[model samples]
Target: MSKTAEEVKRIEEPYVCSKKERLGHALGVLGHDGANTMRGYTMPFLTDILQLPAPFLMILTTLGQVLDAFTDISMGVIADRTRSKWGRFRPWVLRAGPLFCIFMALSFLKLPIGVVGMCAFAGFMYIATGSFAFTAVDIPFWSLPAAMTSNTKERSEIIGGTTTCSSMIIGLTGIVVPLALSAFGKFEWTSYFFTAAIIAVFAICMYLTSFKLVREHVVPDDSVKFSLKLGLKSIFTNQPLLCVQIANVFFLLSIILRSYLNYYYCTYNLGNLSLAAVLSTINTIGMVSGALLFTIFSKRIGKRNCLFISALVCLTSNLVLYFSGWSNVILLFTCAAITTVAIGFGYVCVNAMIADTIEYGEWKTGQRNEAMITSTRCFVTKCVGALASVLVLSSISLTGFVPQATEQTLGALNGFHIMYSLLPAITMVLAATPMFFYKLTEKRHAEIMVELAARKEKKENK
Candidate 1:
């Protein structure tokens, strides 16, 4: 082979991440999903206990995303500027643990205060955790693997491990939260917080542990300082980053909407709330299984190819549910399981692709803006999650949904069908389209690294 090809092959060996490190990295996602079980109870409790209108509840969600989106951008810019012995992201994760624990727990604990309407309660909690508290932790936490290693295979493995672990947590939460709340009953507000508090304790401990085990390998050049304006501008210029962001934001919305819709689907349509556990448990299991399989495929093939397979899975699964009219219980659970598996695959691919974009940005622009890159990722996720809330809740409102009613009208049932099956299928397919344009294959990334290293060496000699 050519001398250039030989040199590129030689440089690739050091970047592959080890198994122990991948496991450590996976532990970090628990910080987000630890309390995820309790999170499943939020909407149900809002309705039965507080009797809040669906529209107003969505207003709180949308407002939080709008208000907190600024924090994502600002945090990204600030993290880029951070200097410490522990590295840029490590300090942020370790420092933010206590605040995340406190605010997240308080958001669940401080509910239904006297004279404060359910509207006020919902507003307070959603903004407190989603916008202000956890946003700090999320941006830095997800940014680590990118900083840890540049190898595509290892990065996919790390992200897949995280996704699988999160699915396991969500699955457990799905089963436990409903059973706990049923035991606590509708009026038992105090009991709900007890569950959340438990989740917080475990969540915080795991987060801190993950931070300690993590070691940042990508050290940026400290001599340069970048304004938030420039950092944001740099992101727009990176095509692959935008492609992944667009696709992922919509993909996030599709799954969250389905998740939010599950309660209504099980309660109103099927007339049994307990079935949510069964469905969620099945879906989460499928997700964990799918992620493990894709992690293997990602190493053999490529990230974009794996992503296409996932998108196809979502599209097909969604279509089956839509055609079934969201009515058949057997089909509903079966399709949800299949679709969730695809979502699991997408989760790993998107994360690995995001890390790859960091390298792309540094190569094209000569700036290692890891925080800026990751922070926008968090912003898109939060913002889309907020928008999904607005859209899904607004559809319910338009259908004339009656909170806490014994039975919803046919119109509302149809709304559930649309939200749960139809829209997700459409968006799932739409999310796949932009992904086709992502061009940074594994081979290209290796060459970019070789080029980046040479550039650094040449500058140092001068």
Candidate 2:
């Protein structure tokens, strides 16, 4: 017979472990699933490889992202209902990881087709197919942390450590890719695609290595029917989930805008592509350091409080960036670092908070749907990403950004500045405002867990 919830909780109590083991596991998961590959490669590909007009490229990419929302949510529902000896999340990751890598590599292949036609085809196929695979892997992977341990403080530590490692990978990509392309003495599309393939292989191997090490404590209920309508109903009815979804839309919108504009600011405003690495390095350092520190502080301050503080810091950093003059690279770097740190703290806590909401949902509806919960998060993220892409590109088009211009017109430069600074700053501030209403606390979570354990025990004994 399966162990009782009380017995399982007791056995899982010594949640702390070696840093290297935890970091490896975290990096393995993040490298394979953190959506880092596209961030590192796609924008550059659109700009440098296909040579499609930026506005058109952005519009197409946004549409592709929007299309993925349905796929991600559907996969989540399927995963929650799936039963496998390999575990619900792990098996999907194993099945989907290589496929995702293959698709990612193929997305970069430069077809001899016309730029617009090729880009449209590539964007549609890659985003649609890759998103399905990604959702399959991602839903379960994220849900595993909650199942990994029930200890609140331990969960924070795990999340913080894992997030730090993940941020490091993201940081490395931001810094190294530009440098690597530069070192190759040519920035051909083929070279970038080849490099991504190599890195993706390594990432997939790392993720696979953890398959044997990490264990899932929760099992899927195969008897439960999976229904898209029911899944939507469950998600819409949950208050905390609703709050998180709304907040995430704004949060992701801000981040996506910042990412889309980063290239523009570096290439045109900063006047050096290499500066991307320097900015990325500083931002990444801030993120890593902040995650580490929050891991330590979360043990004392609690996740909600940490999230609130993080929002304040992020808001302040954005204000600094918006107000600071363009020539002030040092100030910009400092603000970027601060902003990264804030985002780091917020990201870890927010994820942990969502995990807690799974228990809340169970308490309310007598169901555990980690995949559904996670997919909701992904849905918000993708929807926001789509909106951001459209906004950024539309703004560029409105400002008369010329494709292949030797230098940007003053109007184009102004558009870039407003996009890089004003748009993100406004959205971030709005995102943080909703967190004040987030009502879950550690004390409440503890009470919920205790009740859940008793309820499960009574049901099992019968």
Identify the leading candidate in terms of TM-score. Answer: 1
Alpha-carbon error at 446 in model 2, in Å?
Answer: 1.4
TM-score per candidate, in order? 0.92, 0.89
Q: Candidate 2 has which clashing residue pairs, if any?
A: none
Model 2 scores worst on lDDT over the 10 consecutive residues at 31-40
Residue lDDT tens for model 1, 130-231: 777777777887777777876544565676677788888887777776667667764567767787788888887877888778888877766776655657
- Model 2: per-residue Cα lDDT over 1-462, one tens digit each: 244445545633466445554554586666564345444356656665666686666766666676676787777787777777877777776777666766676677778778667867677655744466666676767766665655655666676667777777777777777676666632477777777777778767877776656666555455666666656666777777777666677766766677667766787778776888897788678878888777777769987778778777877778778777568898988888888887877777777777778878877767777788888887776667667666766766687665545487888777777777677677766777777787767667666676777787798799
Q: Identify the leading candidate in terms of lDDT.
A: 1
State the RMSD for candidate 1.
2.5
Q: Which stretches of candidate 2 lie over 4 Å from their true place?
A: 1-24, 33-35, 38-40, 53-59, 185-187, 221-233, 404-406
